[model samples]
Target: MKIIVNAEQRDVSGCTLAKALEELDFISTAIATALNGCFVPREQHAETTLSEGDRLEVLAPMQGG
Candidate 1:
Protein backbone atom coordinates (compact mmCIF):
# COMPACT_ATOMS: atom_id res chain seq x y z
CA MET A 1 0.00 0.00 0.00
CA LYS A 2 1.01 3.63 -0.42
CA ILE A 3 1.27 5.95 2.56
CA ILE A 4 2.83 9.28 3.33
CA VAL A 5 5.54 8.91 5.95
CA ASN A 6 7.23 11.82 7.68
CA ALA A 7 5.99 14.16 5.01
CA GLU A 8 7.25 11.95 2.22
CA GLN A 9 5.44 9.55 -0.05
CA ARG A 10 6.54 5.96 0.23
CA ASP A 11 5.34 2.49 -0.71
CA VAL A 12 4.91 -0.13 1.98
CA SER A 13 2.90 -3.27 2.72
CA GLY A 14 2.35 -2.76 6.44
CA CYS A 15 -1.12 -3.44 7.87
CA THR A 16 -0.64 -1.75 11.26
CA LEU A 17 1.25 1.18 12.73
CA ALA A 18 3.59 -1.11 14.60
CA LYS A 19 4.43 -2.97 11.42
CA ALA A 20 5.09 0.21 9.58
CA LEU A 21 7.46 1.46 12.28
CA GLU A 22 9.26 -1.85 12.23
CA GLU A 23 9.49 -1.79 8.45
CA LEU A 24 10.92 1.71 8.67
CA ASP A 25 13.41 0.58 11.32
CA PHE A 26 12.11 2.92 13.97
CA ILE A 27 12.79 1.56 17.45
CA SER A 28 12.91 4.55 19.74
CA THR A 29 9.88 5.80 21.65
CA ALA A 30 11.20 9.34 21.75
CA ILE A 31 9.33 10.26 18.63
CA ALA A 32 5.71 11.32 18.45
CA THR A 33 3.29 10.00 15.83
CA ALA A 34 0.65 12.05 14.07
CA LEU A 35 -1.75 10.39 11.67
CA ASN A 36 -3.56 12.63 9.21
CA GLY A 37 -3.06 15.69 11.46
CA CYS A 38 -4.19 13.87 14.61
CA PHE A 39 -1.70 13.05 17.30
CA VAL A 40 -1.67 9.35 18.14
CA PRO A 41 -0.61 8.20 21.55
CA ARG A 42 2.36 5.89 21.82
CA GLU A 43 0.28 3.22 23.50
CA GLN A 44 -2.07 3.08 20.53
CA HIS A 45 0.65 2.43 17.99
CA ALA A 46 0.24 -1.31 18.06
CA GLU A 47 -3.46 -1.23 17.21
CA THR A 48 -3.51 1.54 14.64
CA THR A 49 -4.05 0.30 11.11
CA LEU A 50 -2.44 2.06 8.20
CA SER A 51 -4.05 2.33 4.75
CA GLU A 52 -3.31 3.89 1.42
CA GLY A 53 -3.07 7.69 1.44
CA ASP A 54 -2.59 7.76 5.19
CA ARG A 55 -0.44 10.62 6.42
CA LEU A 56 2.05 9.93 9.20
CA GLU A 57 4.32 12.35 10.98
CA VAL A 58 7.15 11.19 13.19
CA LEU A 59 8.49 14.00 15.33
CA ALA A 60 11.37 13.58 17.70
CA PRO A 61 11.58 15.48 20.95
CA MET A 62 14.33 18.01 21.27
CA GLN A 63 16.22 18.87 24.39
CA GLY A 64 18.51 21.81 24.98
CA GLY A 65 20.81 22.85 27.77
Candidate 2:
Protein backbone atom coordinates (compact mmCIF):
# COMPACT_ATOMS: atom_id res chain seq x y z
CA MET A 1 0.00 0.00 0.00
CA LYS A 2 1.07 3.61 -0.58
CA ILE A 3 0.94 6.27 2.11
CA ILE A 4 2.47 9.63 2.81
CA VAL A 5 5.02 9.65 5.61
CA ASN A 6 6.24 13.02 6.82
CA ALA A 7 5.28 14.51 3.52
CA GLU A 8 7.08 11.86 1.51
CA GLN A 9 5.51 9.01 -0.41
CA ARG A 10 6.31 5.51 0.81
CA ASP A 11 5.27 2.00 -0.05
CA VAL A 12 4.64 -0.26 2.91
CA SER A 13 3.42 -3.82 3.28
CA GLY A 14 2.11 -3.60 6.82
CA CYS A 15 -1.62 -3.18 7.35
CA THR A 16 -1.39 -1.83 10.91
CA LEU A 17 0.39 1.23 12.23
CA ALA A 18 2.71 -0.81 14.42
CA LYS A 19 3.85 -3.01 11.57
CA ALA A 20 4.26 -0.01 9.30
CA LEU A 21 6.41 1.75 11.85
CA GLU A 22 8.62 -1.30 12.09
CA GLU A 23 8.93 -1.49 8.31
CA LEU A 24 9.78 2.20 8.22
CA ASP A 25 12.57 1.73 10.79
CA PHE A 26 10.91 3.88 13.38
CA ILE A 27 11.87 1.82 16.41
CA SER A 28 12.07 4.53 19.01
CA THR A 29 9.53 4.28 21.80
CA ALA A 30 9.85 8.00 22.47
CA ILE A 31 8.42 8.94 19.12
CA ALA A 32 4.92 10.29 18.49
CA THR A 33 2.55 9.34 15.68
CA ALA A 34 -0.43 10.91 13.99
CA LEU A 35 -2.73 9.47 11.35
CA ASN A 36 -4.53 11.68 8.88
CA GLY A 37 -3.85 14.68 11.13
CA CYS A 38 -5.24 12.99 14.25
CA PHE A 39 -3.11 12.03 17.21
CA VAL A 40 -2.70 8.30 17.76
CA PRO A 41 -1.80 7.02 21.19
CA ARG A 42 1.10 4.63 21.54
CA GLU A 43 -1.08 1.91 23.01
CA GLN A 44 -3.38 1.98 19.97
CA HIS A 45 -0.67 1.72 17.30
CA ALA A 46 -1.07 -2.01 17.00
CA GLU A 47 -4.78 -1.77 16.33
CA THR A 48 -4.70 1.35 14.16
CA THR A 49 -5.36 0.45 10.56
CA LEU A 50 -3.79 2.33 7.66
CA SER A 51 -5.12 2.77 4.14
CA GLU A 52 -3.81 3.94 0.79
CA GLY A 53 -3.27 7.69 0.45
CA ASP A 54 -3.37 8.04 4.24
CA ARG A 55 -1.09 10.61 5.82
CA LEU A 56 1.19 9.32 8.54
CA GLU A 57 3.37 11.61 10.58
CA VAL A 58 6.13 10.37 12.83
CA LEU A 59 7.75 12.79 15.20
CA ALA A 60 10.61 12.35 17.62
CA PRO A 61 11.62 14.47 20.55
CA MET A 62 14.51 16.84 20.02
CA GLN A 63 17.11 17.78 22.61
CA GLY A 64 17.85 21.43 22.96
CA GLY A 65 18.99 23.85 25.57
Candidate 3:
Protein backbone atom coordinates (compact mmCIF):
# COMPACT_ATOMS: atom_id res chain seq x y z
CA MET A 1 0.00 0.00 0.00
CA LYS A 2 1.06 3.58 -0.58
CA ILE A 3 1.18 5.98 2.36
CA ILE A 4 2.76 9.33 3.12
CA VAL A 5 5.29 8.82 5.82
CA ASN A 6 6.89 11.92 7.26
CA ALA A 7 5.95 13.77 4.09
CA GLU A 8 7.56 11.11 1.88
CA GLN A 9 5.82 8.49 -0.15
CA ARG A 10 6.52 4.92 0.91
CA ASP A 11 5.33 1.53 -0.25
CA VAL A 12 4.66 -0.77 2.65
CA SER A 13 3.40 -4.33 2.73
CA GLY A 14 2.13 -4.32 6.31
CA CYS A 15 -1.41 -3.15 6.93
CA THR A 16 -1.04 -2.64 10.67
CA LEU A 17 1.02 0.10 12.28
CA ALA A 18 3.23 -2.30 14.20
CA LYS A 19 4.00 -4.34 11.13
CA ALA A 20 4.69 -1.22 9.15
CA LEU A 21 7.09 -0.01 11.80
CA GLU A 22 8.89 -3.32 11.66
CA GLU A 23 9.11 -3.15 7.88
CA LEU A 24 10.49 0.38 8.12
CA ASP A 25 13.14 -0.67 10.62
CA PHE A 26 11.63 1.35 13.46
CA ILE A 27 10.33 -1.47 15.59
CA SER A 28 12.98 -1.19 18.27
CA THR A 29 13.37 2.55 18.23
CA ALA A 30 11.81 4.88 20.75
CA ILE A 31 9.45 7.09 18.84
CA ALA A 32 6.00 8.60 18.84
CA THR A 33 3.50 8.23 16.03
CA ALA A 34 0.45 10.09 14.73
CA LEU A 35 -1.92 8.80 12.12
CA ASN A 36 -3.85 11.12 9.83
CA GLY A 37 -3.37 14.00 12.27
CA CYS A 38 -4.49 12.01 15.31
CA PHE A 39 -2.19 10.83 18.07
CA VAL A 40 -1.83 7.06 18.39
CA PRO A 41 -0.86 5.65 21.75
CA ARG A 42 2.03 3.21 21.99
CA GLU A 43 -0.19 0.45 23.34
CA GLN A 44 -2.44 0.71 20.30
CA HIS A 45 0.28 0.55 17.68
CA ALA A 46 -0.15 -3.14 17.20
CA GLU A 47 -3.87 -2.83 16.50
CA THR A 48 -3.83 0.42 14.53
CA THR A 49 -4.50 -0.28 10.88
CA LEU A 50 -3.16 1.82 8.01
CA SER A 51 -4.62 2.54 4.62
CA GLU A 52 -3.54 4.04 1.33
CA GLY A 53 -2.94 7.80 1.26
CA ASP A 54 -2.84 7.93 5.03
CA ARG A 55 -0.48 10.42 6.57
CA LEU A 56 1.85 8.94 9.16
CA GLU A 57 4.18 10.93 11.31
CA VAL A 58 6.99 9.26 13.25
CA LEU A 59 8.74 11.50 15.70
CA ALA A 60 11.79 10.69 17.71
CA PRO A 61 12.80 12.54 20.87
CA MET A 62 15.70 14.93 20.56
CA GLN A 63 18.47 15.14 23.11
CA GLY A 64 19.11 18.84 22.85
CA GLY A 65 16.87 21.48 24.37
Identify the leading candidate in terms of lDDT.
2
Residue 47, candidate 2: Cα error in Å is 0.3
Q: Tell me the TM-score of each prediction against the true structure.
A: 0.88, 0.98, 0.92
Show model 2 residue runs off by greater than 4 Å. Answer: none
lDDT of 3 at 2: 96
lDDT of 3 by residue, 1-65 (tens): 99999999999999999999889888755899999999999899989999999999999988976
Model 3 spans > 4 angstroms off: none
The local distance difference test score of model 3 is: 0.93
Candidate 2 — worst ten consecutive residues by lDDT sum? 48-57
Candidates ranked by TM-score, best first? Answer: 2, 3, 1
Predicted structure with the largest TM-score when compared to the true one: 2
Worst 10 residues of 1 by lDDT: 18-27
What ranges in model 1 sit over 4 Å off?
none
Query: Whose TM-score is higher: candidate 1's or candidate 2's?
Result: 2
